[model samples]
Target: MHSIPKHMPTSTVVSASRGRSAQEDPWWVRWTLISLSVLVLSVLVILPIANVFYHAFSNGVAAYWNNLTGDRETLHAIQLTLFVVPIAVCANVIFGVAAAWAITRFRFPGRTILTTMIDLPFAISPVVAGLMFVLLFGAKGYFGPWLQQHNIQILNAWPAIALVTTFVTLPFVARELIPVMEAIGSEEEIAAISLGANGWQMFWRVTIPNIKWGLLYGVILCNARAMGEFGAVYVVCGRVIGKTETMPIRVNTLFEGGTSETYSSSFAVASLLTMLSLVTLFIKIALEHKTQADLKEAAQTHQTE
Candidate 1:
């Protein structure tokens, strides 16, 4: 009787065969899927971005430049976006790092609940988040009377914009860090503590270095979202032309003006946002490659040891 080969298990052989069969699609089917994907991508992404730039510079490059800088409201919207995004990103970074550290390093009750809550923004609509803030701080909201008595403004102000932005971007950093931290495990941290390092030193020296790439990845995503947010900001900001209007809100306002100039200005502002997204994409890709390289090096070092 023939004996079974020692190198390949029965289960492995069966799974390999199954995988091969699954991948054995006809040549036409494979090409058709690839063609469909490219077509869809061109329609959904490539064409829209190209169209924006086309209209933005339809008159001339000078027109696009003038629209971006000549308009006071557009300039203010750009400035407001610059101001708000940093505050939101900083707040989220602090919260994200602390939350990721806790969730990864300890065992406690309600951990699952805490994890779920981190994902709440993704599950819920930004519009709902905006409405929730309005309900709490708007002129006729729950605290509206108290706010009015004190002559304090939350809704329709920069503060409301910042707060809503922070809420919407709350998860990016933590979500990126959690799996990274979990995969790396706590052995290095434990070893550091054992070697007479203090808690802060251990975190700054060991943990931060280990997770820096992931942290940067998360910050990029958070910054992108904070800059591009519309619905939540719109609801709370009340689209007060210059003061509370962000770049996205400015784009919408210009688009609705229903004139050749306004249309050109809108696309010009949109092109700036698109350019930012493209830059972010490039940086994100570079970080991913760096991260994978670090991971591979670590794995190789471990094997040698």
Candidate 2:
């Protein structure tokens, strides 16, 4: 019989392996990576926002205030944004919940196709999406004659703006909820139904409570995108100054004015959008923390049970 080599001590072998595998990186390499990350962040994110605020107030506080509140065009733009964002967000919430529920809980033909189609907005360009709407609703479009015959306007109007905003933001809520719903599974819902609850009762009493954080997360993201959308809105809004201009469109119009005052005004309006984004970011972070805490608590409860 062949003699086997003696085994090394477990502690010695483990220590040798750890020494080889887990040695700390040279100090300079670590610092270089951290410095590079900070530099890129400053260049890409921090500087642009700071520049916007600087130019926004360059003409002084009075000018900034006047640009935001006193300017008729800016006010109209803000009003249009307010009107469109809510409609888009509300519509998406209903569609999102339904899509997520159908997808996560049921098996059906073309389900894969449906899920793929939900991601179409992300795959397609927003500008192209806007152009598609324009082709469908513009004067030479297929429905154009019918629309014109009825004296109904769709393109170059708020309706077109609302439609495009809804289209672009369509995926946000559904995308956010799909993974969340899948992770949660349907056990609670099945149990609720077995306990004598109806469909609506189970959804409202059980499913909604479970997915509330994820739903809120989706809504916040959807709202942010709806408010800040520029490419599609710009294409369809026709930049009709005070009439159809949203905030982003208004910024473009002001910058195109080619004057120092207009430049300041453009930055002023941009500052508002930036502030909205920052507020959304804050809410998103808080929701994430809440979600993690809830998940941990649920895990503990499950283990105990």
Candidate 3:
């Protein structure tokens, strides 16, 4: 039998015998923390959403429906959001996959610079990101004269809206994919190549399945931001109602117009946005749980192998 070392604290020895049970917080402390979190979420998130639905339908269903459907501008804003989100999501997905593949699979000069460039959009203010496009495409901008001479319209146009939305949402997919790709490594990719699989086939068979969840996670985040983007889109849109207005802009327009139904219309449109956020939250939570399960399964598989 060995004695406890003289340097070892008596408290530490007692705690070691008690194991992890010794470190557990008192039940009241844990319950207090749980109560605080619930209270905060109820006040901040749940209450606001409930209020949006309340204000939205207070005047009745027809009034709410008319606010969304009767106004041509509101309809157009909806259409515009529908148009921009898909295109931006597709573009980002393509760029994200390519960039992640290259960055994770290759070692090269300027690799760090390239990664930094990918993250620049996230670091910059959305307003500043929108301004960069304006300075590039505005009438007095560098290519503005040439564009005008060519009769090309970008500023205050759908293209400008898409461009700014894309800029503001650039990092989501790439950020999601990089770590997954890094973890999966190139072992399977090398094996596929040796077995005569083409690059596309290798990606389809080996890479995609490994990273599909991550890709989906990224796409979800990218889509949420693309649809919800306001600041960058606001600057680039010139707030041309019915033409360039997105859902967020439409909500702002209604609130600021100061009519009898202004509050109703704004909140009604805002209710649509709030619904979108709630849907996004649900999807994100589901994906997070799925990802955790996948990670756990993969770890277990690795250990077995």
How many times do residue backbones clash in model 2?
Answer: 0
TM-score of 1: 0.90
What TM-scores do the predictions have?
0.90, 0.90, 0.90
lDDT digits (tens) for residues 95-153 of candidate 3: 99999999999999999999999999999999999899999999999889999999999
The residue pairs in collision within model 2 are: none
Q: How high a TM-score does candidate 3 get?
A: 0.90
Report lDDT (CA) for all predictions: 0.92, 0.91, 0.90
Q: Work out candidate 3's RMSD over C-alphas.
A: 4.6
Superposed by TM-score, candidate 1 places the C-alpha of residue 179 at a distance from the truth, in angstroms, of 0.3
Weakest 10 consecutive residues, lDDT, candidate 2? Answer: 1-10
Worst 10 residues of 1 by lDDT: 1-10
How many clashing pairs per prediction, in order? 0, 0, 0
- Model 2 scores a C-alpha lDDT of 0.91
lDDT of 3: 0.90
lDDT (Cα, tens digit) per residue for candidate 1, span 67-166: 9999999999999999999999999999999999999999999999999999999887999999999999988899999999999988899989999999
